[model samples]
Target chain A: MRETDFIGGFAKGLKVIEAFDEAKPRLTISDVSKETGLDRATARRCLLTLAELGYAAYDGKFFQLTPKILRLGHAYLSATPLPRLVQPYLDQLSDKVGQSASASVLDGTEIVYVARAAQKRVMSINLMPGSRLPAYCASMGRVLLAALPEAEARAILEASDRRANTPFTKTDPDVLMEEFARVRRQGFAVIDQELEIGLCSIALPLENARGRVVAALNIGAPAAHAAAGEMVERYLPAMREVQAALRQVLA
Target chain B: MRETDFIGGFAKGLKVIEAFDEAKPRLTISDVSKETGLDRATARRCLLTLAELGYAAYDGKFFQLTPKILRLGHAYLSATPLPRLVQPYLDQLSDKVGQSASASVLDGTEIVYVARAAQKRVMSINLMPGSRLPAYCASMGRVLLAALPEAEARAILEASDRRANTPFTKTDPDVLMEEFARVRRQGFAVIDQELEIGLCSIALPLENARGRVVAALNIGAPAAHAAAGEMVERYLPAMREVQAALRQVLA
Candidate 1:
């Protein structure tokens, strides 16, 4: 974290690329500068550098990312063992429960999906690998939070600007603390329509060879079809079974 | 390609990440320096910067990429339109043919997979989003190459390291030129165990609204069940139908 050890230009270049999103797929130089808080000349240089490397394309006016950018993500997935090791278990859990199953790890204050197996669509948003959801309301997020030390979890919660995403979302720190304690005691978390209406999910922490929680696995379904108690009764055991098998592979 | 426009530090950082692959997932500082041809001091700085940014983790001895690195790829996929627009067509094609279907765009001398749908496993390698393959030997690669200008195609071919991956692979430039011409005339490319034994595939070019060959789509099946002629006879019409529908969407 020392200033001398960091490459400031490399980080700034990445920030410029990350400025483009679904809302702003193509952007002008001024837009990039405003999005990244960089000067116009700095932004223009980053865009041109990306274009020169074939990672971005300039179509006369606006700059957009090219498919070549996918290689950065491909490199991570191909080298990482966590996603590959967790995929088969997710597939089996999805098949057994007839729902969508996913594995996610905490990144910053959000949970980034690493692997997924879908049987049916249950959410308004498409939950694929690299999809991220808020740690305050997601079941996988809560389970991951529960696995962390109390002080660390509290620090993350304090840092996040919690809001009521739905009628059932718990935005209060005290309520979330109580929920985290319950999840810690039970070894799992069940979120009942906290993220989206009619979207119910149950999540269990996945432990590594050293018995340290590394990620969380979850199954999502419609609330009308699966109540919280029913989810705990039906899905929890299967998730635990997969978690046990996954531990052996991780070891 | 101007010197002032290029950012050497950013490019070198990415090269350090790309140096870690399936062959060597965890690397020491010396390994990274050797792989990327950077000095030990420079490599150490980049690795430390990556670790500080939470994109990498150093476990005492070796450095490894973290899942957070996927955010870079996610940014590209979320901002780009091609992969999302092509997913449904790939899924329908996979469902219809009972095989794996993928869409890829040519990047340099390689083809990078952008979207995919799998009904069953068909090859020794896992073909998923973010996967890369040698363009000279892949069916999708051939279809994409055929769509380019003849001079441009020849330049790419010349730049590639042509190798006989299998006994049936056509590595000769003259023979490959003839094959490319045939594919251009026929509007599709079918390769019979050229990339790998028992792997047969047929591919069609996907055109954007500007009539540019933006990507290529292909269905892969084992040679035992689907012969090159059988694939063309049974799957070509269906692939063409999807391609026609996709062209409208891209437009």
Candidate 2:
């Protein structure tokens, strides 16, 4: 492709930022090259450029994203209307559901947290507005995935190379497809310790007035506190309430 | 700047996004051009590009930011380490301070909220992770400004066309300089009814490993709740504790 015709270096830089996630927060130059399919030199240039721009930091051998990098995500959040509208509701949901709540939007192949509220002293990793997780394994990702067109969802599932991140993670592509079908039928999705060993999450879609899934909101807690039946019985009503509240404001 | 230099376009687009604040969330092309000095046609293009990228929405005549713009802020919050490290502490401070707490970083002439925790049913504006306010007027901004070198701080003061945002806003550069000096001596700042009518805020700098003030953390509340003695007697200790926690995690 012609250089200008393709997504430009700025886009590529953004993609490189995306390549770093919970599982791969720090990466070597060769790891980035292999992950992003860029030449090692290109990856190095990108890393150096990112460092110069105050987005990446080097600790002798490994490159890690810096807090300055949060500015990009901050820029998006400050300029967007969704997180502002959804956060208070998520906060209230956390109180009502007695668990942590989060809203994530699909960014390429991942689900990035746009808004989140957590109960104090939770077991899972602390996720913030800019945190990203694999879309194929999390409840929020599954909600967005189930909302996507079948072919597109299938493409992501296939390209994702679903890893059994935990024992509960659904790794088989066919199983994921079936799960998507079930989620679509139920209008929500749940993960039982799929993302982390003792963490569970349940998610529902946040659609605009047009009924397009613009984001996914979910609540997570330890598997003991968020048992599948208990989540369905207790949290589902609150989640639906948030979805309705969000629709009113977002619409 | 060359047309090939997308940097200028990017900068202009950022300005367009920045032009919208809590007070002005929607503007016409002419309004944006007048506000940003980019002319109508250029402003239109930027708005259109933003719309195409799902960062903005336009109703032919009036343009407003889209919820999708949250991704920009989300990108930063997820990648940045400082705010993530500071958040739980802010949550604790919210309870200790008996009001809302926010952590902000300087973005050009603005202070972007990277993290916030508000008491329930306190205010209408839900300050999420990416909200931006003019740095010159915010208590958080004063803490940051107080931390700057005298020459650089004076230069910014001279360049700033201090507008009277509220009856309580200090628009005089000389008075603001004295105020900055006082803040520097005391190592904190309290702003009363300046940014908004009922809102009062107190802020302190968050220094990095290099002892540079990289961010500011503040508590805000209605004037009635955050009286001067209460801030000194109750909130300061909590703020200091949060600052200590922030240094432990972020540094």
Candidate 3:
């Protein structure tokens, strides 16, 4: 990353917007300044600019992002073919397995969902296109990690806090390494009550035209509904079918 | 609108990202410069900054926005209550009407779709969240305009190019004024093949908790399947039901 090549102010402006989330839907100028580590003046200017452009709205004091900000995401979705191309397959997989199916790509230490189809709400968390989860604990995350170089996967794993999200979660680096090796050999990964109790998911890597794994496709269901054997028996074939079809289209 | 209040470089950077659409998904630095009206150096810096931040990717010659860019939209969707709150109602409306139902907000001279549910495809254009259509001709657009002050509505109408997209599109200002007046009184708007031939739609304004009209909810069907009278008789009631339900939630 060359410093001369970057526009620092533009990046700072985006950071200001990103500073707001579910927990903090509205913020003051000082709040934004503290969140983005920018001075009060810079944050105030960005907030006012966003408000003026209809991307953010201010009501007296607190500033909140407006729906107009969705245009940025819409631009990416409308222009990119991956989400649209993969949607029908996710829908089919979800319908076939009677669970929620999703596709995600590795983004740094997390996997960002790009496409999702739900048959029934299985998780407490509402998973949508922009939802993200730690790469160390999610089924899709391990599949994505397995696709990366061993050194890179280890680096990401080491960087992660690697906590026991649930009693079943494998937090030890050596154990995770063994699991990643198994996932690479088996061509898929299944997490049984790892990320959360009663939440299980099975995932397989989706390859691009060059046969390089670009994303992970997964089906998540309640553990009470589908155990590890049931997932392998019922969900695996459908996932493979979708993966094969995607490979041809991607090719 | 104030020059000092705005961060011009941030706006310019967003414009650079918006320049990539379905037609031109990839571009060189010069292409971006031409598309955004930014100088070559400015475009290069923005592109490089986006690339370094993982929001974009440059394969040497062509620069394209990456899936990571969707995070911005996700941030908005996660923080905003409108889209999520309105989705299930739109799904119910789509199921009942056996057509497509959508919610949109007026943005400048265009209406941007904020939520959508489709039962069948009726048009050549694939409508989704973030998709924009000219406000002068869309049924939802007319409904939104009808909710605004007469002076503001007329100013927007005057600012629009107001071209005839189809043979039935009303480009005359006087005729449109009469139509807007009718829509305001009737509490809804119906378009009979104004945007595209064979496409008919009925729309009603969706007011937030404050009783201010913030968006429009619409149901669209093919003319062969639903006439203007049928839209009023069938679709209008369903749209109103959704709108009423939404009002409670928004409140």
Candidate 4:
């Protein structure tokens, strides 16, 4: 990893793009500098390049991403086969269960949604493809971690900025470790109000044809209607059926 | 834009990322150099930077994007409001019509899909959010082009690499200009096997609260079952209901 081989300017540009989230859609040079910890001059150069490329729009004082930026994500979705492979299965599971179902791959300390089928909005925020959730708090996240080696999973947990999203959320590393063991033994996981209040989810590991755990599958429902304890009894059987079906197809 | 204001390395990195698509997911440094028109040394450096930053995976000789690259696209979806606002309408329209519904904004000479709802796969390739289609051939593209001034629409058409995708495609700028006028009067456009064989679509312009056309919405079906001419009688009534409903909320 030579320093010259790594383009620092390209890396800084990505940070500037990620700096604009739901809270801050439009950012000035100063705001970008403050959010991404890049120098104002550096941020300005990146923003200008993005604007010139049609990825970002510049309106005098503010810079925001245009829909053209979706082409960057489009490259991933089109080039990668994971999302397309799991989409139909997710749709089928969501239809049969009358709930939202998703498939996500473990990325560092977070789980990134690759495919989803929405029967309805179970979360206040829309969880579509490309959505990210903390591995320590989400049902799919925990199930993905349970498939990893104990030491490796522990490292990811240690690296994460752990926080309790709800009163029921677990922040302690030791408790999370025990939960991982339980998930490994039972072949699935269920959560209630751990990510957000009044939300319950059941999840299972999706193994590839090679028997490697490539992703996790989850079915979510509003806890007011379907209790978390009951989802294991109700949704787990159907989820496992998809899991087995996906294994025959996934590489 | 000033020369110093733009980051050349950052622009080159993005080009490297875009070089991979459904046809070619994995590439070596030499392949990328040729595909992206970058020199071999520069291509190697960009790929190395992507691998070091965890956005790409370098499996010995070949390089490919990891799911982490989705973060780039997620940043756009999470920050943009148009996709989130139109998604539910697309779902409702798809459910009512029993066909695929989508919303897109015209970007240069292409229409970038912002949201989609699929009752089933109508096209040979699945059309989802972030998918792109040439503005000259798609139903939504024609409606959006009709919204623009005639000169502007002509300029976009000239800029496109127009070709016949199907036997029914209209490539003559003269014929397309007249079609645009009809779309403006009728308030919608219909395409029959213009983009692909056995595919038909009907589309209308999506207006903002100010009555400015912000995007285009369409319902696509198989031409085998639903003739392009008959789609007006079957789907237009329901599509107008959603289009009018969307006007109050879109900004």
Candidate 5:
């Protein structure tokens, strides 16, 4: 073991960052220590380093993160090949389909909105970049699941404690598995009012140059406005065209 | 001096990350060493640490960043009070104005787009959440510039050797100083075809509950479509309302 080459402090710093989550945006040193399983002294030192780097800020007794830390995400999004290349297409798709469209990649089991285009005065949900939702409940997540190897996808579904977040949410793994199979067979996914009431989404896979499903493009609208037939008739061709254009641009 | 308390490996590891810039997204190990002012061996050790933590990835001989590093930005944006509070208002303002809108904060002498309501069917520029543009030419930059202390603002203006990226761009410092004066007098900024042709923006200050100008809200549109009078008439009220709403939410 290359003990001399180990960088424990960097790991500690990242762990400190990971300890702060959606539920716990602000944390005390004790909270961080408990969350990261690090000692109080180690946690404090990591926080101090993060603060010095302008990543974390202190509010007298409580510690909160700063926007300067957004550089990391900005760095990745600006540098990434998929989001930038796919965003224009998503925009065009949104306009053509008369609905809000988004592109996202799976981050663990959750789908993160990387790029989004929405109609003016549309649905109340303010979808934008960097927003996160449970992957098991989203149309984009289902497309990603359909793209994955069967065993891996099954493992994720088995481990997931799916929530009935809304009245129509799919809480049963067996049922979700059947949905995944349908998605794979149809080469697309449709989730109707599953995550939120009155919302429906249709997702199509976007393959990179290597023909791997690196991301998913989705269009969402109210069920009343977005009839299933309309999505297939007006949106499918353009969505496929955008995917092909993405492959060309990336190629 | 608590030299022993500080982790050199960790500090060095972070320095490697700090070395990346908008100009330099990918770097070789030697480039990292030069940028961080570290010896090659030390840099290599730090890179290994970062790679192990999934923050950095090595692409053959060159080292690049990965999406896992988005955790850093997500942590900050999720925790920060300003962006979280301002985002919904920005969306509402975009809907009301029937145009794209954005909010950015100062980073050194450049303006970074922190939140945006990008429009469908518009030619997607390189501007994303982390993207940066020079402070001298952008409407948002001018609003931010007008807000700064005279000495600090003058220092930035004096040090900047502005480039005329487009025919309408104001490069001369004297001319920019006059523009700044106009913006300060009007309590708003309008940039016409400065950074890019056919692009125009109008920006106004967004004060917090304490009335400190923490950020600026800007509406961007194609110059052909965005008349100055119409923007003021249709967008100004919404912009003002959002500004008020942002302060209330944050408070």
Candidate 6:
């Protein structure tokens, strides 16, 4: 982790890739620089490199990522066993519960979805594998953070770009701290429209045989039909069964 | 696209990311060097940078990609509208057809799955977003290739790592050229046990409003129950309906 070992251009290239999101899919060099905080020259070089490598395409003014960029994520999904291992369980759980079930692991201030099984014609957010949600707001994110040491969890919370995503979102760090404690005490976390309106989700930390938290599992449904407390009363037992079952197999 | 404009280090970093797969997940500097054809010093520096950036984990000797690597793919899926636009259609089509449906776009010699909907307890391939299949053997691959000009398609076939994944796989370049012509004439493609033993699939080009083939759509079922011809007979009409409707909406 020495400073000299870092490849600044490579890191900048990755940051440039992340700078294109849902709100802005096409970006110019100056737009990328503004989004990623890199100099315009550096951003142009990275964007040009991406285009030269076939990961992106530049139409005179703006650079947009192509499907080639998925190859990068494909490497991770193909290499890792977590998604394949949890997929069957996610499928079975989602079918039985008639909702969407997913597995995700914590990464800094976000949770990245690894496996997902969505039931037909129910939920609307349409999260697939490789989707990401902010750690401060998602149910899976809260459960994963609750598994960490209090100080480390607090630091991640402090580092998060905290903002109110919905009217129900708890944006205060102190309020979020208490929610973490509640999750730790209850052995699961629940979010009622904190991420988006009409979405209610409940999550539990999926621990390995050695009791190390490897990922978090959750099932989401529409809040109109399944309230936060109702989700707990109805789905928590089934989710706990899957959690306990996963503990025996996950290494 | 100038060679001087290309950042070699950044390209090498992407190659390093691709070097990890199911058979070899945790790799050392020498293993990566061997896999990517980069020298040991260069690979070591790239690995260290990835570790520092939290994309990889280095436990003294081996460098393993963490789930954080998925953020790279997440950026693409979130930014692109194709997957979101196709999911609802995939859901309805798969449900009506009682099989699995997917959409993909061609990238180099591969077809990367962009969106997928699996009917309950039917498909075994379990292709989610970011999954890749060889463009030579897949039905969707052939349809995508057929949409290209003959010389461009032939060039791609020559560049492909042609191998008999199954005994039924057409490995000869000349034979595949004929198949591409057939696909172009018939307006669709079908594969029976080419990619895998028990899988059968049919694909049609998904043209946009301007009649440009932007992606391929397909439905896959067990080869035993639904032969390749039967799949076309049963599901082709519904798939064509979706394709025609999507043409009006997809601009």
Docking outcome class, model 1: medium
**Looking at candidate 5, what is the lDDT of residue A222?**
81
What TM-score would each prediction reach against the true structure?
0.93, 0.78, 0.88, 0.94, 0.89, 0.96
User: Can you rank all candidates by DockQ, best first?
Assistant: 6, 4, 1, 3, 5, 2
Pick by lDDT: 3 or 5, better one:
3
Instruction: Show the lowest summed lDDT stretch of 10 residues, model 1 chain A.
Output: A118-127
Candidate 5 lDDT, A1-251, residue by residue in tens? 17666678877887888787657888999999999999999988888777766677777567777656676677767766667677777777787778888998776677877787766534454556666777888999999988888788878877766889788898787788889899989888888788887778889888878898888988887878976556666677888888888876764
Candidate 3: RMSD over Cα atoms?
A: 3.0
Best by DockQ: 6
DockQ of 5: 0.50
lDDT scores of the candidates, listed in order: 0.87, 0.75, 0.85, 0.90, 0.77, 0.90
Off by over 4 Å in 5: A1-3, A120-125, A158-161, A227-230, B1-8, B18-27, B120-124, B158-161, B171-178, B227-234
DockQ per model, Cα: 0.66, 0.23, 0.55, 0.73, 0.50, 0.81
Tens digit per residue, CA lDDT, model 2, B27-130: 89888899889988777777777666656677887787654454554544555676667877887888775688889887556677877766654545656666
Candidate 6 wrongly placed segments (more than 4 Å): B121-124
Q: How would you encode candidate 6's per-residue C-alpha lDDT over B172-233 as one tens digit per residue?
A: 88999999999999889999989888888999999998999999999988888798779888
Question: What TM-score would chain A of each candidate receive against the reference chain A?
Answer: 0.96, 0.82, 0.95, 0.96, 0.90, 0.93
Clash pairs for candidate 4: none
Error of 3 at B249 (Å): 2.2
Name the better of 3 and 4 by DockQ. Answer: 4
The ten-residue window of minimal lDDT in model 3 chain A covers A118-127
In the range A1-251, model 4's lDDT, one tens digit per residue, is 88989888889988888888777889999999999999989999999999999889999999999887777777887888888899889888888988889999989999998888877566877777788999988999999999999999999999988899999999899999999999999999889899999999989999999999989999999998799989988898899899999999897
Native-to-model Cα distance after best TM-score fit, residue B44 in candidate 6, in Å:
0.5
| Per-residue accuracy of model 6 over A1-251 as CA lDDT, tens digit each | 67878888889899999999889989999999999999988899999999988999999899999999988888888888888889899988988888889999998999989999887545456777888789999999999999999999999999999888889998788899899999999999999999888888999999999999999999988887798889988999899989999998898
lDDT string, candidate 3, A202-246, tens digits: 999999878989789999989999886689888998899999999
Candidate 3 lDDT score relative to the true structure: 0.85
**Model 5, residue pairs in steric clash:** none
lDDT per residue as tens, model 2, A157-233:
88885788888888888899899999999999988888888887789999988787889999887877757667787
